[model samples]
Target: MASLSQLIAKPATFSVSTPRTSSGQYRPRRATVQCASSRGGERSEPDAPKHQDRRDPRRARRQCHRHPDVRASRRRRPRRDARRLLLRRRGPSAERQRATCCPPPSSAPAVDFTPPDAASLPLRTRPAAHSVTADYVAKFNAGIAAMKALPPDDPRSFSAQASVHCAYCDGSYSPEGFPGVELQVHNSWLFFPFHRCYLYFFERILGSLVGDPSFAMPFWNWDAPDGMRLPAMYADQSSQLYDPRRDGRHGTPKLIDLDYSGTEPRFTDKQQVDHNLRVMYRQMVSLSPTPSLFFGSAYRAGDDPNQGPGPLENVPHGPVHVWCGDPKQPAREDMGNFYSAGNDPLFYAHHANIDRMWSVWKGIDARRHTDLTDPDWLDASFLFYDETPQLVRIRVRDVLDTGSLRYQYQDVPLPWTAARPTVTRRADSLLAPAAQAAAAAARKAGDFPITLDEATSVTVKRPVAGKRSKAEKASEEEVLVIDGIEVDRDVAAKFDVFVNAEDHGAVGSGGRELAGSFVNVPHRHGHGRGRGRGHGKNGGGIKTKLRLALNEQLEDLKAEDDESVVVTLVPRQGKGKVKIGGVKIELMH
Candidate 1:
């Protein structure tokens, strides 16, 4: 082999030729270098003759490009001394063009984010909408009026605040570095914390307008039977809280359907109340038993938005939005759709109750049902203009504590906690042996990636049962995962999910067959007038997954030892708009 010193002295030579393009721009051409000897025992390259056209600019350029020594010598040249010469040779315009073409990709706008510290402000108690006093209603109305009076351009104005909500929920903005992917706060772990931060700033803005530092907002206590109807305050047409773009039939004195599916139920007042309580019970307790089951699927940076929604966000949460929205309008404007939801003054109260549920969920099972500890969940941040009209970036971690935010929901009776769904029917009793055998055959024959134009069912195989401790089986749950859900982003769609059910239509929360649902409130693509709300372009399709905890259901169905479970999907709204990719069951740790 050649000595190291000799190899260094006679380094391999190469050249990158700059070919002229049709646009009169020089493009660098790929150059190849070869060793002097293939075996590398000794390698050498002849030096160029020193007398051969040394002053010719083209020859000098080729020589410089070909040799490493020339490049080193160029860097060693004093920059200050050669600055004028290089500038004169290239011309300022050429240099500018080069810099422009090679501009740094890191120039994305720096977010002016500041995580807030523990608040020292006096705790503000948010009153329930139905229970608020006459004075409280007057103050809240005044605040809303003042906000509406502000110019649309003002960040603290009601319209601007509505726009903020629209932009985040709808596919208006993308995450940093992900210019094409939407920044959706719904349908994932971000749902709770993002709204908490949003409400915190909004409440602050409202209080500032009303000149009450300790002023708190009201929560629509729709979970309770007495507060199931639209709050009387929002029903008053003359009040600032009223929004014309709502279901006219679903006004005060008409109870809101917690699991509304666009069709009005024939249930009387008492029946509706009982049904609504069961829905709350199912979504909060039965369906959501673990942190992952409650918070939703993980969505990290660069990941596509709308990974999935938790049980609460799927049912009463989505159903309530659709119930309040005007059905006559295209895409269910105002309360029914994401972009126009914030336009309704009741949106805040509705969300306040939703936010309260986050706290309530933690209280239900302090050991298991807790906030997700994922760092991505904690660090996920959003930008919002505060009461001062200053852009402030808030993280999920900052709003996890309502006390730190200096606000608390009024202590009220949780009637749904006692309304836990009891097993009223069993699959074996409802499904005859023949029907059960037919279901198994259908699951075996059913194809993957089925369209949801009508009722669909496919039996998916569960994980093979292994030897596990009794404690392990009790703590760990089996989760049914419906993966690769593709749907149009602009449509309001819903489909109820059932596991091991004989008839999906007949099953309700009373049966173990009824698992949960997946729903979407239509949202416009960009900030344009499109399908759902505002003048926005249509959005690209959404691909997401749905997860349901099925431990209790498996026991009720007596399918703990069974290898496969029949999964049924019944389309209640927006049929032919959704596609299911596949289904499987996994063990939830």
Candidate 2:
């Protein structure tokens, strides 16, 4: 019945030992800190607990009774009938719901098309920013100019193309059956599919305008060290590719921080590159080994569109947006704000990289080559105007394979796959006897398992005076290890973790109190085999630990003598649940 903080207050005795590796180096085996807990707070010391099988009929029935969305899905009937029922349930909001229940008057021509044969269509290769040739640059500039020259009303025109992003993302439209609910597509499962289709049509429009069916959109390859700078082609003031409303501070020579929130840190170019590569490895290779983790949570019919973003979307996708937007401008217009993001010419190029990641993710292994099988996910539809100025209804099922869409990206080296952070200092040397004792005591503290359903903060009070050493005081760095993060295998939930954040909403707005994020990689049923070799036999839900290097975050909190440190978890979107079994802090030497 003791709280984690209370347990930490009463120190527990422990010892540390140094082990040697085959390389004749002293490898410190970190003491095993067992802090596992079951649903009823029963303690367990197993190495790793097996996640609950989602395919179990009993578990499904239990979840169905507990979750409102699951219950609604079970009772779902025909679309028309469901709309009527949803509207009636709106009560006083019924009048507003009627507009969405009825179809809008269509003025745009309908699109009729056949899926193009992959072999027959020309493959438009999007080259990386660093590898783009002078000839390719010329073509890209020409294509942009031609698109810009088109009339404002033309769907292929630059203005019209930008408006498409504004309309859908900025709440210009609502779901057909849910009138009062705004259709916000940024933070949900729709993030990937919707943007994929948008870029597909936009690329086609550019090709048509340039009179070259093979003209491909260039991608801003920010993942690699060489491609970290904003592509030089877009910075040319005289070129059509140039956008005047970008962050002046983020011009050429400034490296892109994949984990950028808002503030700039003092990291050497090499350090920044190494950090970026490590982040890429974590997001693409380690964290995301399944479709649900890669693509994000599902947003089906009659559901809200904020059900969490995948790792790719949450990280580089969002940070890149904030990094590019002019900080001086109100709301960071152009690339920063959702409604005006596409207005910037570089937006398409930036998204081209995001789209390229999807292709690269699929090619990583055979098990990851599949898409979501849920009928609601597969059949989810969005409206967009294609090259012909004809409104087309694109389904999630239509764009699963990029090859079928008649485009591809230039193959590039994935340096992050082999990137592993090396420990320069010996653990014993870094942790003095006193520090070691403190760490062991902290580990013995009872685990605190908190379920995140909404914005919540937990405060842990621990005296800091006696815990500090000369090295710790000089470095002011520590490691925060969170163990046993478990989420439902079927739900793609993600939450941003923050320490000492006064306002949860402002956590990632360039605040110094921001900690890392916890992204869930959900289980895929009937996949025969799992995507990554790490999954092994146990593959039901996201159950893993996070070791965050919190030197900077802790320094920002100035909690050296503070009695309590508040940790906050903010869900990216919609409703999803996650449970954390324990938290530990160790000195990082």
Candidate 3:
């Protein structure tokens, strides 16, 4: 019988050919082949060269397409939209293309979880970063030391626990039935669920080793002003929780920038705190009003990870990782890189806060209080070793309710609740009553829609309504409204949207033309029925909308008289392609 690995290695199909030259010498001509599973049956031009040992099972497995049968079916079926096909072939574009008709293999039933009796399993409330007492800190330290002292081979040991992250995220483990594909948890809808489960087991192990079932991991509440800096408890050099490989400049007392992307302009303490609060407001309340936007792109079984990142994951998530990583190290060792992020004890605390935000967002409104209903999302599963050293599989649906996991975050004030955009009173005064009424009416009507699926610059010409007079142009309230932004699948890709920018490369935080940006959070494809604001049309993907108050930006560009304004879509960190279903330039009252 074949070994487990061999059995899991599915056969990949390829066509073979050998054409002889006219001369005595023989020149072989290879048939062009396409991998059916690669980005929705898109053709892979120029087939690879033939190998000598074609009969070798290992070689065949390596060379075979992920879904050869699907490719055959695609050839038999009619072609799809030429524009969408062209967009896919051109690489990452914002166009929404149809997925392959070949449906993914049915997943196993959702993982089962029988919650222990409330009285038997004590609930643990994670303390706030600023409020943890000295005794609580001591216990936390003791738990870390105990975890580190365990035998290296033990699954609960510090090294073993960290390896779980590397294996799942760093491409060390292949999905159980898909050997050629690596299992990745980041950059998709799985970001929240996977990390939540990981933290669940890690916290359990820590608590078990410390002999305190009620012990809860403290969260690094970077969203709040007081919790911006590294928690004081973790900064002690001698403590087991202290990881030496952290950003040297990020020690306590230095205000943490929530929008940190390597370099940030120095701001006064008060200024930085205000900025952090505004960012929180934008991420939690303003931008993410739906499950798809809040949780990110949906990742289904057998798909590649990192399709897109949710808003929270994009901002504080990736930036926090970059900020915590040691600058001197090549791979940013502990906290910066994906493979080694879990090595830093701080990673858990960081994720705990991310988990906390999910709970908090759910309470914000009725529409936000649910998870995606797609079976591919709900049934998605991952394996992890529990405290008993027995490997266990968990599903996304299992952890939807944090209370079921027997842990909750300590209650804290949400300052972003009152946070508001700091528009100057003078700019506010420019809006005439007639213009304001018109803007409100236009918003309700949903006009001026445009679709974008590529990284290109588009100029929106001001609508020529009988040629606007100078006074009319000055009084007109214009807003760059990006609505119904959706993606075809789960991915962690984001693009920086700019206005009237000369060079995309030169634009940065301080760049004058930088208007705003959007992250295409990961969501599952073919599951487009979303609940809440800016929901996508049925048969489309998950959608969200953004309205950039661009009065000041346009004034800076001196573009009031210009016939059109140029908007550039530049991807951040070279993430994959995404699609924008609709955009509109609204000349509000």
Best by TM-score: 1
Per-residue lDDT over 30-50 for candidate 1, one digit per residue giving the tens place of the 0 to 100 score: 111111111111111123231
- Per-residue lDDT, model 1, residue 270, is 88
lDDT of 3 by residue, 39-113 (tens): 322332123332224234353334332210100000111322222111011111223122111111111211234
Evaluated at residue 438, the lDDT of candidate 2 is 32
Task: Quote each prediction's TM-score.
Answer: 0.77, 0.61, 0.62
Task: Answer with 1 or 2, whichever has the higher lDDT.
Answer: 1
lDDT comparing candidate 1 with the true structure: 0.65
Tens-digit lDDT track of model 2 for 471-520 = 55445435555666665433445566666544556333234455667543
- RMSD of each candidate relative to the true structure: 16.6, 19.6, 14.3
**After superposition, which runs of candidate 3 have C-alpha atoms over 4 Å from their true positions?**
1-112, 175-181, 423-457, 460-495, 498-589
Task: Mark the regions of model 1 whose C-alpha exceeds 4 Å error after superposition.
Answer: 1-120, 175-179, 424-427, 466-470, 508-510, 525-539
Q: Which candidate comes out best when scored by lDDT?
A: 1
lDDT (0 to 1) per candidate: 0.65, 0.54, 0.55
Q: Please list the residue runs of candidate 2 whose C-alpha ends up more than 4 Å from where it truly belongs after superposition.
A: 1-109, 118-120, 176-179, 421-515, 518-589
